[model samples]
Every structure is written in C-alpha cells, then in structure tokens.
Target: MCTETALRRENGDRFCLSTAQAETLLTGAPWRRFLVIGDEVADGRGEPAEGYGHDGWADRVAASLRRIQPGLAYLNLGRKGRLAAEIRSRQLGRVLEFKPDLTALTCCGAELVRDPFDADSVEAEFDRVVAPLRDSGGDVLLVNWFDITRFSPRSSEETERLRIRLRELAERKQAVALRHGAIYVNLAEHPAAADRDVFGADGSAPTMRGHAIAAASVIQGLGAHLTGAGDACR
Candidate 1:
C-alpha cells in the first residue's frame, strides 16, 4: 500500500492521498492489466521531479494500483518522437494482444508540435487506435497535453498562437472521448497545468510535479468507476 504522499499543485496547494485513502480510492477496481500507449507524453518523458522518483504519471498510477492490488500488471509501450500513425501501427497490435482491461492513450502531440499538422487525419488515427479498446470493454483513459505553450521561448504572438493550437487539440480530444465513452483529462485546460514549472525545461514533456498532477487526475477519474459510482468494465 502507498504511504502518505502529496501530489502538489503549483499554487502552493497540495493534494495528498495516503495509503489508506489510496486503498479506498482504488479498492475493487477491476484493473488486472494496465497498458499505456502513445508518444512522449505516454512515455512520461521528462526531467526527474525534485522529490519524486524519475517515473512518469503512468508509473505513479501503476504504483498506486500495485499498492492496492499488489499484482497489477502494467506495461508502457510509449516511445519518444513517435507520431500518432506510428503509435497506431506499432503499438496497437501489442496492446490488443495484452488484453488489458484498463488503458491510457496519448500521442497526437508529435503532430501538434510540427508544422502543417492535419487535425482531421490525426483525429482519425486516434479514433482507430482507441475504437478497438472501447469495443473490447476496456476502461479507457485519454490524457491530453499540458499548457506547455507557456514555456515556449517564442515571441508573445507565437506563444499565444501555440496556446490556441493547444485549445483546439483539447476540443478534439473531448469530442473523441464523448464519441468513445472514454474518460478525458485535458491537462492543457487543468489549472495546475497553467503553472509553467510543471513543464520540463525543454517545453515538451512534463516535469516531475507535472507527472504528479497527471497521476492524480488518472486516479480521481477512475475513482467513480472503481468505487462502483459509475460504469464498471470487465
């Protein structure tokens, strides 16, 4: 079981989930296998957090699940620099083979950061990647980007444009979630994501503090399903 831990926010506010609380929060969750797939975000790529170990949000989430179930199976098929299409082509097959009941997906950022991004094509690829999971009765967790534009060293106008682009991506993600009945957590829109410190110095991946925020969101989103307050998956 997890000991007392603080998932901190940038504004001096901290969210703590102790061992008992974590156990309660995740007890009865029907997750025997947890699979994470996507790009850099999915890989939890970033600098080591100040106090937290050098793991991504998915690791933290898996750790919590282990504390509760002790035997939870977790695998991360995420790689840095992989675009959405590559993720769908390379990772999706192995993912289906895993027969995971719980899964996390994120990848479009590779396209989002590049010039000449085709929103519709990326969205289509994402749909293809997630639809099978949704149909296979897997509980899907869809995480979007953080507000990393705030960390951009570009000119103010360019930075604002990047923010706008992020907002567009968030909208598409929400639509996809609604279409697939998946739980969507848009860190780009989260209050804590507004803190530039949550991003790494590279302005692409998250810092350790950012990972904490992502993990907390995943747990909180699952609480309803885990506690039987919402839909339960097989």
Candidate 2:
C-alpha cells in the first residue's frame, strides 16, 4: 500500500515517494518505450535539491520504470512556454515516431495563465494531441494544473472567477482522459499542490521535491489500474 508516506522532509514538509518506492509500487509494469509530451511541466522543469527527487518528475518516473523493466527507453518532448497549438504541432509528431507503450501528456501552464481564456480552443488542443496517441494503442496519462493562484493570495473577484475556469479546465481534461481510457491524475485536487515547499524559487514550477510527489501520484494513479489499490483516475 504505497501510502502518501513521507519519504523525507524538507523544512518540516513531508515529501512523498522515493525512486525505490515508486519502483516497488510499479512492480510488474510492462511498458518499454515511454514518451512524455506536453508543456514545461511535462518537460520536468526544476532543480534537484538534496534529499528530494532530482531532475524532472518524468525522469524520476522513468527511472523507476527502468528498475522494473531495466530496458525502458524514455523521451521527453516537452518545451517550456509552448502553447497548446505548438505542442500539438511540434511535439506530437515525434511521439508517434517513438511508438511508446506508455505516454504522458500535460499542457496546462500556458492556457491557464492566459487572460480571456478560451475553453473550446484549449479543449481542441488537448484533443488534437491526445487523440492521436490514443489511436496508437498505448497507455496515456494526463495531469491537471494545480491551483497556482493559491501560492499568491488574490482577493480580486476576477481571481475567484479564474478559479472556476480552472476547475472547468480540469473537467475538460478529465473528459478527454475518460474518453480515451487514459489515466488522469487530478493534481488540481491534490492538497499538497497548494503547499509552498513543492514549488520552485520562481513561485511557479515544481521543485524536485514536488517532482517526487508527482511521480508518486502517477504511480498512485496507475495503482488502481495496475493492482486496483491506488488513487482513482476519474
């Protein structure tokens, strides 16, 4: 039972999951070729702090998968600041070429931060990237953006309104995940996302410690599908 047990603590905050624990949870996994595509977060932007997971979360996830399969090939096509259309255009073609058995897609940072949000356009971009991978007959994973605004308290009515929009965005992502039978990890609802320790110095991207938690969450999301004992993707 991979509890949200703290693997270690930094500044009194509990960081969950070590690479070894993730491996234990993912034991018996059969994926070989793995592709990660999306925005910067999917790219795993963050520095490695001592005692926390290093590199990007995707790499951490791959490292664990490697322990189990020992021959996993991982490729990350995520670029920071790439808009949804650009991600769909640039990264996805390479993904098809990789033909991975397992894949992860996350494109939230750009659109969620944009003003005058377009739900339909964002949804379209999501579908464009997600649909093709689904056609490839591989397992797909999706993650929602955490409520970034929580890091900075904004009392403005517009901020509250944007929160509503964020929830709607999560729903849209879930619909896509459900439609394709992909695993969706609802980072938006995870209480730890609101914690300050998980964020980077820039106040936006995840810290490597945050990466550990995210990797654990991915394993946790797969747990139900794999062993029927982890968090529900829906």
Alpha-carbon deviation at 126 in model 2, angstroms: 1.5
- The per-prediction tally of clashing pairs is 0, 0
In candidate 1, list every pair of residues with a backbone clash: none
Give model 1 RMSD, 1 decimal: 3.3
Residue range 135-164, candidate 1, lDDT tens digits:
999888888877777778778997887777
Off by over 4 Å in 1: 1-13, 227-234
Q: Candidate 2's C-alpha lDDT?
A: 0.76
All candidates: CA RMSD (Å): 3.3, 3.5
Worst 10 residues of 1 by lDDT: 1-10
Error of 1 at 100 (Å): 0.6
